[model samples]
Target chain A: MARPMGSVRLKKTNPATLAVGVALCIFIIYFLIGPSTSDFSASRKATAAAHHLSPPTSPFRKPTGDKQKPPPVAHYNLNNVTTTPNPLENRENILLLTPMARFYQEYWDNILRLEYPHELITLGFILPRTKEGNDATRELQKRIALTQNQGPEKDRFKSIIILREDIDPPLTSQDEKERHKMENQKARRAAMAKARNSLLYSTLGPATSWILWLDADVVETPPTIIQDLASHDQAITVPNCFQRYWNEEKNEMDERPYDFNNWQDSPTALDLAKKMDPDDILLEGYAEMATFRTLMAYMSRENGRLHEEMPLDGVGGAALLVKADVHRDGAMFPPFAFYNLIETEGFAKMSKRLGWQPVGLPNYKVYHYNE
Target chain B: MARPMGSVRLKKTNPATLAVGVALCIFIIYFLIGPSTSDFSASRKATAAAHHLSPPTSPFRKPTGDKQKPPPVAHYNLNNVTTTPNPLENRENILLLTPMARFYQEYWDNILRLEYPHELITLGFILPRTKEGNDATRELQKRIALTQNQGPEKDRFKSIIILREDIDPPLTSQDEKERHKMENQKARRAAMAKARNSLLYSTLGPATSWILWLDADVVETPPTIIQDLASHDQAITVPNCFQRYWNEEKNEMDERPYDFNNWQDSPTALDLAKKMDPDDILLEGYAEMATFRTLMAYMSRENGRLHEEMPLDGVGGAALLVKADVHRDGAMFPPFAFYNLIETEGFAKMSKRLGWQPVGLPNYKVYHYNE
Candidate 1:
């Protein structure tokens, strides 16, 4: 400092200057290590919603006098689920959904097909709709109620009999650019809603603790898969997909493994709206899996909840299992008003909201045939 | 004819025809009841040179010129050996060849690459060629001699030794199109011949009861490979080779086992000529393996050796072990004016003269590099 040494001066400091410098250093450290060090912002969700949410529009369309009738659906949230834990605990509940098609043969040909660990998988069946004509045919409606009235097996875990009357007719999106990109998502959602509706309005409805869905094409389902799943409380998915790669294609019948890359990519509403044609459908859309772990990840800021999204592009629907309470608290799968692509996507949405994660095990695969 | 009933007439058979017919009836019964089944054809030698071979016509040929210049090798037949069995025979006197190679480092980075009933597998060294360059150049002649001298670890059960000089090499060929297909054949033969020559002339000149030629690339070369070979007093090849059309380009690595299809188009020659280049050079072109059991197959019609030639292409040398007497009795590698093409072919030629049949092992696949 004596010779004004070109900004590299070593000078004696006063008490005030020293104090100021220390304060500045502390500020710099705080600024550098702040954001990544904590999840305080994410944790304070209540305040963010208040400040972030957009204003809602006019409810009931401003009480139009022309409203002589109410909406046909009496339920609010459409998912309407009963939230109550069953009094009978430790029953080792199991849920199996038997869609109308191919159910009889599947039951005779399958069901106790092989051995499994004791008390691991309990079976349940859900009767699918016979017809989805305009206002839901009476005969089909009668079948839904009759099947629900039949009740569950003696050893069955499904105390809550889910009745499914409303079914979406098959409609192929003809978007040449968008393929089966969104099949898993849309199908899963609709299926989930149908299952929830039936379960919610059953005699032993509240007693039900678990629900399982199986694909109709499955020829031989391995029992050990369920046993392994039951071993862990963590949300999981048994590996159920396979692909044909450049090298793996050469594998003999005995050498084949489940492939993943060949999954159907479900599209989103925005993309579908542009061009809704099956031929135009592109196989690039995706959906999230209905899993407790995944839901938790989505709720939290970390876990990379937005990663590759396994099982989302297309949930097999061939097999799925879920807890009853999970649906009640999560509001369950909502009925789709405008589209039939709800079964797969609806379940994923509900599971995510309920804070469940999904996992796929490699040793498990479902044998099935598809046209 | 007594009556023209569909031109049928009662006629007495000629005495010769009657005998033949009786024999044929007996043969049919014997065939039907004998439980005719093929055993592990490890005893049969394939087509080798036919008998009554014409000696080389060259003016400088051995017998016509100088008998002292190491007369051309003599063929082995049952009439040449002592028929009386030696009761003193303890463990089959065996020869073991274990050669070290560059890429084979994984076998023995440590522990001497030992994997076996140690009594089997007499580990040997790779052959070395003469060097002509500077200090960087290793002398090939010196190296080959040194390698043979050092040989495999000395062991009691495997007193018989195998060296690279056992094989004969050639210089040229009459057909170029056919010659290019061999794998390092030229150099390998030269080294093999030199190895045999050096061993035969060395202090341990007399081969033990048996000699073995082991291929280095063989993995999982079970002790049984050696034990199995030793069990037979006669020469044998575990994995006898057969002409196989392996389209390396197909499926890259989905190679099926060698079978009849590939061999159907192969040449017809004495297992000897099959083993040698037409110019009498060493060539390992045949499809199968040959051992002392091989010699037994060719032992002779009167000697009780009735092994029919299966026409195998080559014999694996991974654990080749042959009786010393077989070599001592003037049995030796065929002369190769050019390069050796097939080893099994060479062994097959020697085998036929010795009345041996080369047989193939269906299940024995000595560890070999697929790449």
Candidate 2:
């Protein structure tokens, strides 16, 4: 009888214990509920702005009778015309981009984002889309703002988006049929269309005077590259794009021959060579013929003129440029989506044709990671 | 009076002493007679051989005259209708005689006369004579001997010979004011003549395949050079004849690029080449390009059909070869002594006109010194 009464009393509630429990529950609810509402609201605003980021258009300060003015261009000589908010100083700049490899594998943000005292126009991309396994190449593929900066990465930027074969694309022929070989090749051709088309290049604003396009793997510094893109009123050039590749001969990656030691014993790949000039390189054995490394760069099908024995059409594209408002009648690269070392040929040819010199400047250098 | 008488006696009264002295003198004369006669005869024979050595012609040994005669050539076979002696074992066996730059230096005695077991049919020589203070280039000369003995030092025979202008034969200048200059130039040209017009080459015998004439300042060594030269059975080829010039920047001479690094940035000196190929190398970089090295030893200049450009006018005399007994239809080298490096071209024109070939062997790997 005594035990039964004690159990009953114990089951009943204790006043002091209930009060403490209520206070703890209340504090937990307040802490959790307060921060969440604000965080959600901020995330919604950020998403909305990204979605609203639209390409700009020129406003109408002139009557409908007047012809549409050329898009903002990097123009000089202020006395010729007048307008508010000079595009060269305040407008956004656009750059057409490509991948560093057969695919994209890098972070690119704010490559041409107009910031800091200047406005950016747009970012053009040359993407290779839709490919499957074994069709993939070593290249950079994606473009994204850095997680740390919310804008651009330290040095890498995808000024132009370079899309390669589709990631995880379906394999059409899994039965190991040889007939699929032709289909595989067809897919490759289609993937490169974005880069080959000229429509993308023609879109650069008329107001833009300096157009720069870097590989997807390239990075940018200071978030904005507007100030860095400015150039003198002459042909623009850059030193060789630096890169690091594995060499099988020495069984290691080496900088001695390519990045160091200076190329020696190489042949002059050109047909019109002269005796070694007094100012030319110093060397030991001609057996190695290393000097031809540069000539190989020049005589390539992509970098130079269509000489009788040579078919090269351009130069390297690792880091390339052109004056936006340059008055040359034709200033476009060949309409080929892919070329072997022919990017710089376009600049070299146009320069030669126009009697303007395209000289590589010592100070103009780029460290390209040519994996 | 006594002194005068004594002096007269000393002069006149020596009959008894004279008889004794005469007898002693007669004995000595008798003792030396055999050796003195032998020395006189030997000297006369040597002088005659030096000035008037000629090939032995076998009229009775002609195949038509003898039913059983030794084959026209020993070890003759269709497989080797023509052959080039090995460079090592046959260094002196196959002679290349040319007055490139080493011929002018004065030597107390010539090595060819000392080392060889056989009478050296040394056929090439730079002409004219020289003394002190004539032509500032006098000191830049050497002596070379191309002989029948194959040996290491056989190639040391190339040298510049400064011809003596003040000779009875006379060297008239086309320009009176430039007589001295013209004379100096004439000497060099004459040296070239010794190479192009030599009887020894004519007598290498009809069975012989080629004659290689090299310049003085070249550098080379390899045990297999002879085998390599013999390997290329073409009608005309030149052993390597690289040209070396001072590079101001590197402060040393370097071989021109062959791999195209700078697109023929440096050229081979024109004088360095003696090509028999139909192509016009003049339009290319013959100035410092290494493609023109003097390693030639090929078919005689009788292969008229081999050359087209400049028509095998004849090959440069620097490093040349000819098919033995292939009658020459081409003109010989120019009457002038030397025109920088034009000797090869001069001979080529002559060969082309006459329908012969002047071949070069690029594999011979000969390097000329840097002046």
B-chain TM-scores per prediction:
0.43, 0.41
Of candidate 2 chain B, the 10-residue stretch with the lowest lDDT total is: B24-33
Runs with alpha carbons beyond 4 Å of true place in candidate 1: A1-371, B1-89, B98-103, B106-123, B130-191, B196-207, B240-319, B337-344
Predicted chain A of candidate 1: TM-score: 0.43
Residue by residue across B1-371, what tens digits does model 1's lDDT show?
Answer: 11121111011100110100000000000000000011101112221111100000101111233322321111111111121123123322233444322223322321133332233222233332211111111232233223223323221111112112111122332233332333434334433433332232221111123455544434434444544544444544444212223466784433223211101112333354456543444322233321112221122233332223233434434345455433432223322331223233444444433344445444443334333
- Could you give candidate 2's per-residue lDDT for residues A240-291 as a string of tens digits? 3333446789789742111111111124422112343322222211333222
The fnat of each candidate, in order, is 0.00, 0.00
Error of 2 at A165 (Å): 10
Error of 2 at A199 (Å): 6.3
- Residue-level lDDT tens digits of model 1 in A1-371: 02121111111100111100000000000000001101211121211110000000001111135532321110111011211132123433344544333233443245444333112232323333332221222332333233223322111121112222323343333332232224433443334344433332221122233555554345456655444444444342434532222444555543223222223233443355345442122221133221111211112122332222244322334555544433322223333421222334434443443345544443345554421
